[model samples]
Target: QLGRCRSVKEFEKLNRIGEGTYGIVYRARDTLTDETVALKKVRMDNEKDGMPISSLREITLLLQLRHPNIVELKEVVVGNHLESIFLVMGYCEQDLASLLENMQTPFSEAQVKCIILQVLKGLQYLHENYVIHRDLKVSNLLMTDKGCVKIADFGLARTYGMPPKPMTPKVVTLWYRAPELLLGMTTQTTSIDMWAMGCILAELQPHKPLLPGTSEIHQIDLIVQLLGTPNENIWPGFSKLPLVSQYTLRKQPY
Candidate 1:
């Protein structure tokens, strides 16, 4: 069980890191520990409603996950105002998305490999525990000053059974979505993350998004363009997908 929620007054806020789907994160100094930490202010505006489901899911999952490559959720803290809650997490210098945008120079091949390797390791642990990070993107991957990469954000993550249950295909972002997901496959697996990883790896090389499609249909078109049109020979049961009929797929070959 979670310990008594500490007051946010114990920490000194430095600057805002960034806003996530569920809350706004800030860099802070933990007075008691004298250590830097990320304080994510949980967005709970509705007083009538206790806590948001997304925040609850993230807190529950993060509390259970323990891995070097995964961001550590130190504890839950609160502010003086009602509904002002915060999540104390391990501090990281920068996220991969920010680095990609602001860096003067692009990452070297070895550097990219190092980052991706750590991400894969983190992802490996998650998969081993039957957890799926439904939303895997560059912004969610953070790096410390020591070059250590940690996977953050678990709002869309959920553990799966031996035979996975049906998941919403709308979970992942359009650009990094897997082909199967684009074809309206509600069932998901670790392979969906691997597909995003492939996109991330390619993006690292080019220093830009690999598949920045405007919409879902456009995203599929781009994927087909890069990898060629999929067929039964390439992807078994591709023709039977629910959304396949919506597209006039080109006869492009790999």
Candidate 2:
């Protein structure tokens, strides 16, 4: 299967669409099938190693994922040299971040519900398969012209088994990060993604980010201000989290 991978020359790059932390994506056309696709060229400039671990993880996960709500990885293609590689993914017309930035009006209640439902469905599938999408945010959610929503960007995703292994607490974007993550909980679960989902659902209504904090300290402060400080009564063992003693939380009973 590795030897049969197609060459990047088979596709015609229409234009550059976007760039992610791991790669640069292009809107391209398959010359043979005349089908439009998203070509993501893996960034290997800084890597002395064969392939980046993030890209390898993404390729491994995407190849096994077969849900409509998840972005599809059609195939892996290559460039002139052995080091040059590209991922052929299903093309999306727009991402929520861009749409939110450019829209003149906010999404209607019904529309917001529809988008959230799709995302929830996708998250359900991921969780069922024991995959945790560590980085779930508006920018990672893509939409097709037909209004189909796809969860994209899997660089930080990981598959968890029983007892869930401890992971880095710094996986998610600060604005959408869950309180547990901010408090330095190493054992993560689907709750982190759900927390981000809540942020996305809230943002769609006002067409703005719910907690747009500039820094981690400010992010935690914003969350505390909105929902009040977490206590043992509400959040059992909240005081025992790894980083709980790092900051002095205000006493607010909201």
The best candidate by TM-score is 2
lDDT of 2 by residue, 227-253 (tens): 998899999989999999999988878
RMSD of 2: 0.9
Per-candidate local distance difference test: 0.90, 0.93
What TM-score would each prediction reach against the true structure? 0.95, 0.98
Candidate 1: worst-modelled 10 consecutive residues by lDDT: 43-52
Question: How well does candidate 1 score on lDDT at residue 156?
Answer: 87
- Model 1 C-alpha lDDT per residue in residues 1-118, reported as the tens digit of each score: 3357889999999999898768999999999999999999998866477778888989989999999999999999888865788999999999999999998899999999899999
What's each prediction's clash count?
0, 0
lDDT computed for candidate 2: 0.93
